[model samples]
Target: MFGGRALATLTRYRGGLGAAALAVAVVLLGLIEPTEYFALDQFFELRGARSPVAPIVIVSVDESSFVELNTQWPFPRAMHARLIDLIAAGRPRAIGIDLILDLPSARGERDDAALGEAVARAGNVVLAAAPADEQAGYTSLPFSYSRTTPNLPIDAVRKGAAGVGAINTPLDSDGRLRRMPRRQWTGVEWLPGFDVELHRVVTAAGLPAAPLPAVDPILINFSGPLRTFPWVSYFQVMNGTVEPTFFADKIVLVGPTSDQMHDVFATPFTRGRDQMPGVEIHANALQTYITGQPIREAPVWVSTVVAVAAALLAAALVVRLHPLRALAAVSLLWVIVTLFAYLVFVSGHAWMRGMAGTLGLVLGYGVTVVDHFVREQRERRRLAQFFSPEVLNEVVRHRREQSLSSSRRMVTVLFADIRGFTALSEKLAPEEVAEMLREYLTETTDVIFKHGGTVDKYIGDCVMALYNAPLQDPDHVLHAMQTALELQERTLKVSARWEQRLGTAIRSGIGINTGEAVVGTMGSRQRLEYTAIGDTINLGSRLEALTKEYGVAIVISEFTRRRLNADFLTRELGEVTVRGRTQPVKIYGVLPADLRKHPRAVIDVSATLTLSGAGESHPVATRDVSEGGMALAGVPEAWAVGTRVEVRCEGGQLPGPLAADAIVAWRRGDEAGITFVALDPESGPIVADYLSRRRSR
Candidate 1:
């Protein structure tokens, strides 16, 4: 049993658990390097461009040089020899030629000899080399690479160059070049990168050298996109269009930059057709080495912990707040995380990859919103049982705190009971009796709901309802009265049908009162009921019981009668002491205009009626009379239905002439039906006494 209870409790809070799980899952997925690299690229993009620390120049073999020299493809090796001779004359600290010279020139040995001689004279040139094949191995250290063999320059050029460095630029899984291997293993020995070799040469010439990190492959702090460094055409340097002093003490890199060469690759700043050439990538890498401030990535464990903490925090906040407020709070947190990561990247030269945390926050918030919506729908379904649709919607929309809490407030309470139901049930089978009760209760509940009343509860043959408790209704008293009248009208029709089928007739009585009452959910903690308790409620119940004593279908307290907005016909039933109250409560019987079959005293009285438009008086004799209406004979045919007339009755135990305004209800031949529209104050007691004496006989 304890296990079952535990399972139920877990089911109730599953939404919160689900949100936390998804957040952690997303953080784990972000640990993959490729997934986090995208955020690093955005940091670079947001930082824009900066000046490189080292003085570097690019000898670009670009379109402009091709057009100016009138040359096509692979300008003869003698031209490169002339360009190197011009740069060497400047006494530069270092010169890196970013072209592979693994094979002899097609222009013959003399062509290759000329380039080799230029390198011999310069004594500071670094030639590019590559691996023999695509095969490479990973070392135990993070991001380290090794190659088994190298494809070096030809013997002639190799003998002259100061160093032959690997021109291998490694790309991440997404094909973006952001880091370079500091050195590669060639099985026999270690080979330095082209930029590393240039840095060594520059330091050897007595320039200060920045210490490199112990890590094998290092992130390059790229200053910008293509052409960020100073550039001069290769052909211009050969023809002396550029001065040699420009290369003095500067690191010069010579390589292809034309679109036809196809030596460019995507970088952090690459967008649309703009890409960085391989030579410029080497320049950026060399600058990073010279400055010794390469971009360092946060350890995997540190980033993972931060991501998880951020996710959990977001989940806690969203579950406690309203959905709209939660959305705003989550959005603010996302911005802070992104800005913090960017600041660390720019100022501290570190990359944190904060996208994981932001993504987790969004997912947590989204799932929590869905959970709230589902729970609200369930609560709505539960409340729908006791309130009408309109009242239920209002309750859900506003959700006032005092709606279900105990409080004292002015309200109109109604009690309705089915008369003679116990005696009728005794004569029928249990199934038949249940069916009868269901039909009767269904009709009564509908009428109460139609007038915007809350059904408090059902006690066997009785239904209790309240107005202006859970939701406010300024005209609650009037609404209760209307509900009672309509309820009785419908019950009479139902009773007639049941009488024909079961051989017994039934009726219902309603009592309504308006006063201060304590209304709300009240009972044990395990089971509670929404009801009213006060002397006002008790008095309302007493009035319903008095209906049988006074032979009336509906009764209302003086408090309720005083609050009615519209005129209604009622008869005072004198004051009586109720069961629970010391004071005698005044009650009135409600008379509906269409109540035609009420108890009547058979009597004949002479009466004269004046028609409103006929301008004459007519003589009529009363056949029978009730407080609501009277049956008449010997009426003129001109008195049609809905004709207004004045009625004055004399004699027949009426101590004086009783005057009242009435309207013709129905007519057949010379007999007309008259219903009292208004009665003089003095005429009320006279009519009551005459009917009382006639009933006594």
Candidate 2:
């Protein structure tokens, strides 16, 4: 049960948190972060230097060119001359310009005259070819399509040199230039980009070449994710500063590299490099192609599954575990994966994943934790509603106490009954009886207020009331006695009206006793009840039943009567033997409080004839009494003392059976008889006390 409850609680907790967490994870993983993650992936593809193998190197017009020339966008044609002279002096292979000479500019006539003459003179030069992009009247054809503006200058470049290389680098969604364009179209011809053009140039110049390895294209023998190669400034190369022989028989590709150009791309070689140019990317691409081993290209579905599954798995695991454990586990997994991913990039020439996996685990754990706590609080509230009003109060008290590491004490109990209730019920209609009973009990119950009594319950016409509380009452007996007397007076008023209406009279009797009993909640966890209970409670019940034997309307046990401190008119009802008690107890009746002041103390007894009339002497032990009945163990089976009989005593002749049995109460289940002879001495005082107490109330 414990394991099941714990598991269920954990499940519910995670279930709720998972829902909200799922939403956040979806937003971040699917919508917001993918673009960035994919972008990183793209940049890595290009800079990874592991694909589209081809031998090539950059001849860049980077920050150095701009800074030395004191100009930004437009470079004088004479600059092209100096670059060409340097390459031509080396007697090198192909030289592909990575920039555009698209239209004539301010110094165009002078610069173009010098550069064009020099370009025509140099046998190894490939002037840069600029296609009219969509922004400049070139239609957005697929990269393979040859659509362009009328002034693309492709024919002019084709006529001026060994070849016009298309220098466009194709990028993936991640903005990384991974794959080199296989081909680019001009108005009249198909062409290779700088990487391919340079490849042809190098080979024609008698360089070594080999078949490239490929996943898509081929991998290049070049630095991986973090490796770096050397670089020198363009202006320095042109000022007769570089050893031109290094350029000999070497293929060079060149273009701009400045942050202002906004040509910067995400690549593995340099982190979103500001001054790297398009020609450098092309050079990287060629190296990748020539090396022949491309990074393994995984299918798209693999990525999606890995991302979502990682999220779900981590979430499920943490749903039942403690939060700290879940978090530590997630963190450890993240670190392990990150290390492995870096190794793939460094050693395997592959980029796996970065932040996506980490985010998935964290989101899973967080969502489940939030859900668990909310469910716990709600369950406690739901349980509180399932108990009865009385029991609920006590259970709640105990529960609150338990939370604070405490508990409640046991309570005392008392029970009372009306004498001759069966005969009373026999004379009335059910409806009339019910109405009268309700009114009578209501009045009696109200007296419990002065007595500090809590009415425990009602059984037929009987009342079970308790003192010493809902809390302890210091003078509980006084309260019980006072309350009982008030009830008697109130019953008289209620009975008078009903008697007139029903043409019948009513009388009630009460018995009360008190003792400590177990008092607290007891029941199922789902539903608990609070009540006092013990042998003390059972004793109170047994005492109420014995009231009829003594022929007294109110009888209290020795335990109860002893708590009283005040003196009052009273009568000693003969010893009454009750069921469940092996011994008999002396019971007492509270005399009416004002018995001395008025006609009071009413004692009413009724006896049914159980056995009588035969001519036999009753047992001797049965004949000894103070003019009162003794419940005899040795009575004749059928005895009739003919209205009176004498007892044979040891010392002298004793009282007759009729006289000795004067106070024998009504026979109610093996009961002794009350004879008329014993009533003379006590009748006046009892009646006076009953009336007096009734009046006081």
Find the candidate with the highest lDDT and give its number: 1
> Residue by residue across 459-537, what tens digits does model 1's lDDT show?
8999999999789999899789889888866776686688679865567888888899998778874577988999999
The prediction achieving the highest TM-score against the true structure is 1
TM-score of each: 0.49, 0.41
> Lowest lDDT 10-mer window, candidate 1?
396-405
Candidate 2: where is the Cα deviation over 4 Å? 1-82, 91-93, 104-127, 130-154, 160-163, 169-192, 200-229, 232-239, 257-274, 292-300, 372-697
Error of 1 at 637 (Å): 99
Backbone clashes in model 1, listed as residue pairs: none
Candidate 2 per-residue C-alpha lDDT over 1-697 given as tens digits, one digit per residue, 9 for 90 to 100: 3455546544554553454356455544555345535534554554455433333445556677788867666677677777777777777677777667667645746666677666666766765665454443345655444346423333333356665666666565555555665456665666655566566666677777645443433323334443243345677677767767877766666566666666556554445433345556666666655554456543444444455555665665665467788778878887787777766756676645454555556665666566556765675577668866677667544433311111244334555544566877777788877887788778877877667888877878877777775676677777787776666556556755875687555555667676667665555655664455666677777766765544555677777776766554455666766676777877776543323123322122221232323334543333212222232334343332212322222222211112222222223233233333223443434333434444422
Q: Indicate the residue-level lDDT of 473 in model 2.
A: 69
How much lDDT does each candidate structure score?
A: 0.80, 0.56
